[model samples]
Target: MRRAPTQKRSRDRVENILKAACELISASGSDTMKMGELAEKAGVSIGSLYQYFPDKASIIHALAERYNEESQHCLDEALADVTTQSGLIAAFDQLIDTYYDLFLAEPVICDIWTGTQADKTLRDMELEVSRANAQSLVRTILRLRDNDGDGATFAARCLLIMYTGEATMRLAISVPASEGREIISSYKRMMGRELSEMLQV
Candidate 1:
């Protein structure tokens, strides 16, 4: 972004730009979307759009950040009430289902995620976010283990689980709905097994 939106009006303009971009992305794909079209759709001047976001990738990156932030909020909510092993497992199941539904509902997110595969910068951002999320899970697991000594093994396993969960979601959303749902189900089962043993019974 060339300049961060500071005032309320600027922030609203930024939101409008992103909203227009998302609509365009859903209608076509982000690859073919043009800045002029986004500016026109957003009812903002092209200069204003460029002021907030220098290019298409930055706009898409903002969208990715927003989506991830929302997902993180869901994870935080799930974390808040989960103290026991079964609660943790149920939270994981709920989060998986929530994300699956989110991906299904948000076509723009799907397109942006697909673009990340080809963009090294976006891919690295995703990996960094995954590590941060994994640390949250690791901490929760440690609490379950009575705050046992940092649990290096658990830390590594949590990171692997986080990576696998993302991979599973990407794969699950690619197939037909029936098969995609089955794939998610299988992942939930596998994840349950992975998480169950890591915590106290």
Candidate 2:
């Protein structure tokens, strides 16, 4: 953004702009998104929109940041009560389901996934968010399994699971709902089995 919104009204305007942009990108592909249309949908002046975001990429980046924040909050909540092995499995299931639902509910997420890949800054931001989430998962795992060896190795494994889950989810999101559910279920089973074995080792 050119300047961060300081006042409440300015912040609200920025939020509206981002919301409108998300809706537009969800309905129509991001390649065709127009600043004028975004401003009109947001019920804000074009100048006001420009005052916050200079271009469409910036708007998408802000939306991506919003998604990351929401996802992190969901992860925290899902993992909060995890202690036993069963609890960990349940937490992982909940996390996967939550993300699947989120991806299906927000079409703009598809845009964020595909659109931000080429942008190094956006990709770095996403990676940082993912790493933070992985760190949280690592802490939970270490707390539950006090004897587990090498915290860094365990954390890397956790990161791998997250990356694989995201890849599966990306593919699942494009398929039919029934097929997607099956794909996710298969993933959960595989991940659960692997985790069970890992905990035993």
Candidate 3:
């Protein structure tokens, strides 16, 4: 945002703007979303909208941040009780289910996922979020298992899992619901096999 909304009313207006933008983008991809249209949908003046988000990219960035925050919360909750190999697999299952449901519920996620790949700023933000998640996974693994392996190496492996899972999720979300389920099921099976093998090593 160009300036953070300090007042309650200001914050509400910004929220409306973001909500309107997401609805618009969800209905008709981000490329067609204009600031004037967004302002009208948000029931705010164009100047008022500009006060919080200077441009389209800023609005998209804010939306991306929101998505990232929600995803982080889901991951944290899913990992909260993980302390064994089976628990880790179950945690991953919950995480994947949460993401799949989120994508279905929030159509804006499709745009955000694609946008991050093309925008450097968004991509960097994505990597930062991934690294944080990887660290969280690393800590969980160490707490559950006794290993003398390099911590950084384990973290890097966790990062790989996160990225691959995300990529598979993107693809899963892009297909029909039935096909998406099958895709996620296959993904979980593959991940379960890999993680089970890792536990043995």
Most accurate candidate by lDDT: 1
Q: CA lDDT of each candidate? A: 0.86, 0.83, 0.85
Model 1 regions more than 4 Å off: none
lDDT of candidate 2 vs native?
Answer: 0.83
Clashes of each: 0, 0, 0
Model 2, runs deviating above 4 Å: none
In candidate 3, stretches whose alpha carbon ends up further than 4 angstroms from where it belongs are: 146-148
lDDT of 1 at 74: 78
Candidate 2 weakest lDDT stretch, 10 residues: 192-201
lDDT tens per residue, model 3, 82-128: 77899999889878887888788887988888666789998788888
Residue 175's lDDT in candidate 1 = 84
Clashes of 2: 0
What value does the lDDT take at residue 134 in candidate 3?
A: 84
Model 2 clash pairs are none
TM-score ranking from best to worst?
A: 1, 3, 2
- Report the lDDT tens digits of candidate 1 across residue range 50-168: 88889999999999999888877778778876879999999999899989888889899888786778888888878877887788888888888788645788878888888788878
